[model samples]
Target chain A: MTDTAIEAADLTLAYGRRREPALRGCSFRLATGRVCALVGPNGAGKSTLLALAAGLLRPTSGRLAVLGTTPAAARPRVAYVAQDKPLHPGLSVAETLRLGAELNAGSWDAALAAQVAADGELDPGARVRSLSGGQRTRLALALALGKRAELLLLDEPMADLDPLARNRLMGTLMAEAAEHGTTVVMSSHIIGELADACDHLLLVSGGRVRLGGGIDDLVHAHALVTGTGRVADLARHTVVESRATGRGLTALIRTDGPVDPAWDVEEPSLEELLLAHLRAPDAPALITPGTTPTRAVAA
Target chain B: MVEYRIDRRSGVATYLQIVQQTRQALRLGLLEPGDKLPTAREVVEATAVNPNTVLKAYRELEREGLVEARRGLGTFVRRSLGGAPADTPLHGELLEWATRARAAGLDREDTAALFAAVLEEKFPQPHAAPEQAVPQPQPPPERTLPQPQSVPHGTTTEGDPA
Candidate 1:
């Protein structure tokens, strides 16, 4: 069995006859049994990437795979929870979940769906239109979970949830992923929430993957160092993103080896790393952070 | 079938609460070797706590050899302590006090006296059962239960009465 749940190689996609591609040369492999967050600013092509993975939109160039099969061939193994709520407005929660089970053409566990609904605090008798935003999101999650797909794709799963609801939903997703070994690729704008839950992260910006790796390794490779001396002296070794405080300059430096004790070194958070990449021009083609880059394969 | 309770108003982090409850369950023989735990998802739903918190607790438990995770099968009670002495991590006692304080509506100061009284009444130190001995099987002490406090709007504790 292939260890990868989803793989994309040199993918370039555009909407209709649009002059510019929505996503260009995007490539990444989502390993099985890991939670990956696809993060980017608005119009950074997060949706396009998810769509290509889900087989909802065909890529104009390159290849995509879901569960070691071409996107089309792996449709049954992939479950896409679209950004637009896809529930039937007329259907009650139970009926909506039932319909999903019927439509997926994959293993569907009715009992699991009922359990997920109950766990998410959704009343099966409630109609879809009557549910609150958080409830609707939970219902979507339940529907996705019940499908028992090998790869689950979620687009902005926490978009409409309040802080508390978001926490609860994230928790549910994490638990489900850990317990079942489900390979999940979810997109989110909430960087902090994603940092806490996801083991691996993908930062997509300007139609390319600027940062990708395990969270710890990324943090270790990028040191937030502050010094009193002119930062240009440090520029050769580090990427200076900012200067700060009264007397010192704070720089985000990429180091190939252990950090020197002379400089106060702190790990850059996921958000800091993302912002740095999004700001730089002609950024490294792929910054694997503390590891060698893997070969990009077209599905 | 370990029974656990959590007060949403507690100052303690939820993961610490989970650790204490798991320890208590072990001491009480409520769970046996190989007993399945509610998946992290189930625990979060049951307690209304963060999933990461549940994971943190489970991870600690796994490290302590108190629980084991079976890939695709969920977490399970691995080895039973059987009333034997077990190491209570530093956070464990802090968590117990926090839980009691919330239940009784007491602040940090009030927790000490109540904790002392309970300790003296149950396992007096010395012949005192080991620090991690089974929670003395006594009826829950009769402390003045806190009157329900009006929770502030938008606070996470709003729905949960203290």
Candidate 2:
């Protein structure tokens, strides 16, 4: 099987005949056994992309694969938790878990499900409707954990969770990744929180890919340069965002070559860098796997 | 007993931040030899960071001889930076000198600049021996810490931390 958990080539999709495409020409490769964070503004098709990966929606045109199989074919091996974390309200937590186990009979992990329940402080006897939002999220994650699927596609998995619960869930998820080599794709609006868990990134905006690559390479390639006189025009790097400072221009730029010695250069935080790319959605994406920006993404 | 907390807003890498918090705790004598560090799972749960990130930080500390991992128990502090408190004789002299410099009307930044310059002159750095040729200075404790080892540069860039 291919090492990539998700791969798409010129993927595009539209909801209806006259509707604007929810995703446009999206292409990227997310390696197996890595946690990738998906981030963008609301209405930027983040949900659409997750749904597509989970086999809930078909790409209108172009090829997409999950776990080296078509998303639909991979459904049995992939566990997906929607934003709402849908579960039967009348069922007790134990019953909910029991139902998930029944549905995923061949691969269900009772131990993992129990661990998640314990971490979230869930009582299996409690009814789903009596649970808090965070508790419901926990139950949804527990259901996913019990499935023991190879790839997990989670949309805002931590949204309803408190900070402590969120951290615990991420910790549990990370342990799963390390122990079992599971590939996870999680969409979150919390940039800092996402940066902590995801080593790779796939940033989308307005239904188009803004950038994609290892987070370290992406961060290292870009820098914040503050210097005198039209620093934005620095020849080597691609200026992502530029602003006038008291003395001159301070810009966030992507540099493959050495930054000029005159500028006061600092590494931009992930949030700053992500926000810059998201702010300039029209700028051409730099599909970088390493230092050299070798691929030119289609416009 | 020092718990590492990651400030996501900071430019520091997660592992480096963990290392810095440990070192900072050491400097303040909050963490002593034989004290246990939070387990990898515990850190991951508290910080919401990748488990590997926590392991990487602990590994870095182990490499530095600052902490040791016993078989399945937990990581423990092996030693400390052993900095003296601010009231030490060396600091007393520095404070006395600072008062005189202030009386001479040196602004805060100027005083700091002049003090750094004087310290560098008086304690000229050791001549670069074969082993000491690299000139990378340690980052200030407050600045965003970096882990050249954890964060590798693409294509082996010259300024890459490693």
lDDT by residue for model 2 over A226-256, one digit each (tens)? 8895853576678888888897898888875
Model 2, range B1-162, lDDT digits (tens) per residue? 667788876756789899989988876678877789987766766677777778888887887667789997889877665545445576787788999989999999999999788766665544423343322222222232232333221122123111
DockQ value for model 1:
0.08
Give the chain B TM-score for each candidate: 0.52, 0.60
lDDT tens readout by residue for model 1, A1-299: 77778777778887768567888887776778777888988888898888888888988988777777788887787788889868888999989987888886558867767776786688889999999877888888888888887888999988987777776666666666756777788898777667656767888877787677765556666777776766666655657376675788777777655544556666666678777777774557454633222455444
In candidate 2, which residue ranges exceed 4 Å CA deviation? A290-299, B1-3, B9-11, B23-39, B62-162
Candidate 1: list runs displaced more than 4 Å: A16-18, A119-126, A285-299, B1-162
Q: Residue A144 error for model 1, in Å?
A: 1.1
